[model samples]
Each structure stands twice: as structure tokens, then as C-alpha cells.
Target: MTAETQAAPVVSYGRLVPVVVHFDDLDALGLLHNARYPVMVERAWTALWHERGFGFDGDWEAAGDFCNAVKELRIGYEAPVNRPGAYAVHLWLERLGNTGLTYGFRFCSADGAMTYAHGTRVLVRLDAATLRPTPWSEPFRAVGRELLRRAS
Candidate 1:
């Protein structure tokens, strides 16, 4: 992809989802701390699940289905988000494997001048009971594949 075409934080033909910020996410500097990046990712993952109609409540441990492990996480920060307001987060699927998924994220500032952060994450699916790596079920594979098709 050319730099011009790949510039967006979330570049998918599908809808660009938004994730609002929380007051408690701030650090002493008033901007969101670096540690909160992963937390936002988890939320984005959950939001994606809901958007796809795959029900995953906060009760993953009790439901016997979950994103059990993260294989990789990388982020780059370009600006500080210290203001108190809702921010937009974009997510897209790069690779959807049988037992795992890779995601790309772009965090846009409220003012939309700079991209505060961008990242890619790989996660492994696991059996809720065994807590071990396992291939995705048919429904999951299908849903994930459909989602990836919308990627720009």
C-alpha cells in the first residue's frame, strides 16, 4: 500500500468504530498514560465482537470462550491526548487465522490534527476450560473471515 493510501489510523472499507475515552485513563501528566493503550485495545476487541454479533460479555471466564492470549502488541505514539473528551479509535483486521487474529488500530485525537497512537495486535484463541491454544470454531472462522473482507 502506498503511504498516501495507508495513512489512516483505521483503513477499512467497513464502518469506522469509535471508542470514547474515560476520565480515569489519564496519568499525572493529564494525558492518557502509555499503559492505557492495551486497555483500549481490549475494549476495541470487545466492541468488534459485539459488532460482529459474537456475544462476549465481561463474563468470558464464565462463558468458556475468550481471547485467552495476546501473541503480539506494538504501538507508536505521535501526540499527547490530555484533554477531557471522547476520542475515536479505528480497528481493522489484517490477518484472520484459524486459531488467531491480527488487528491494526489507529487512535485519533479529539481535534483530529495528529494520530496519538497506532498498533497491531495478534491474539490466540484458547479453550476456556483447558486454557490452551485451539483452532477457532466454524462460526468464529466464518464471522472473522467476513469481517476481514471489509478491510481497506
Candidate 2:
């Protein structure tokens, strides 16, 4: 399907994670620095993952599920964040595969009425020892399914 004709992915409110745009994240023009967008999103995702008990605690063997690495990221700016304040990063699973998954996200106003940016992030699960692509664990997939977008 053409870009214009493609259906927008459904957003899951349960996956919306609140984030703050700090003063340091702003540029001389008083707008959010372009480079900070992905950083902010990463922070949000990390927070979410931590909340779900996914993180490395100095043990390589126990960090398999959290060994995922970003393979690709694409963002489209829709508007500039004019000030440092409360915002949100809505996240949802776009595609889930054996060794990787694509996540859709939007940086938007707190109420989600205005989108500042939107994008997709592709991540590949990795084997803890080999540090190579590996299939995601069933537990990880189960958690991801909760944020997965429903088929239209």
C-alpha cells in the first residue's frame, strides 16, 4: 500500500510512558534539540523496561532478555517541542519476529493531542554470550504482546 493509503497503527494507551524534557535538552532557539528526541525516547523505554523488571544487574547469564540492541531507528518530526515540560512517549509493538521486533512510537503532548514526532525502532535480541542475534524468550514475547498493536 502507498504511504498515504496505509492505515495508521492503533495506539495502546496502556503503553504510554510519561517523559520530561529537561532544560538541557533544549537548544539555543529554546526548542528541543533534534538529537535529544531519540535520547528521550530511549530514557522512556528504559524506564518502562526497568519497571517491568528487565535490566542488567551485573550478571551476564541473567541478562539475556535485556540483551536486545537497536538495529535501526527512523523518526519524523511533526512539530518542535517549544518548552521544557511534561510530555509523553506512546509506544506499541508494530512487528514481532523471532529475533527482533519493531516498535512504533510518538512523542506527543501530555494529553496526546499534539504529536511532536513519531517513529519506529527496530531491535534485535542477542545471545548473552555470543552477542549475536537470538530468538526472544517466551516471557519477553509475552510482555511485548501486551503492547502489540491490534491488526486492522
- Report residue 119 deviation for candidate 2 (angstroms): 0.3
Q: What is the lDDT of candidate 2?
A: 0.82
Candidate lDDT scores, in order, read 0.68, 0.82
Best by TM-score: 2
TM-score of each: 0.75, 0.87
Model 2 clash pairs are: none
Give lDDT tens digits, candidate 2, residues 1-152.
Answer: 33223233434433677787889889999999999999888887887778787877878778877787899999999999989888878888899899999998999876667899999999999888899899998887888888788876
- lDDT score for residue 18 of model 2: 75
- RMSD of candidate 1 to the truth, in angstroms, is 6.8
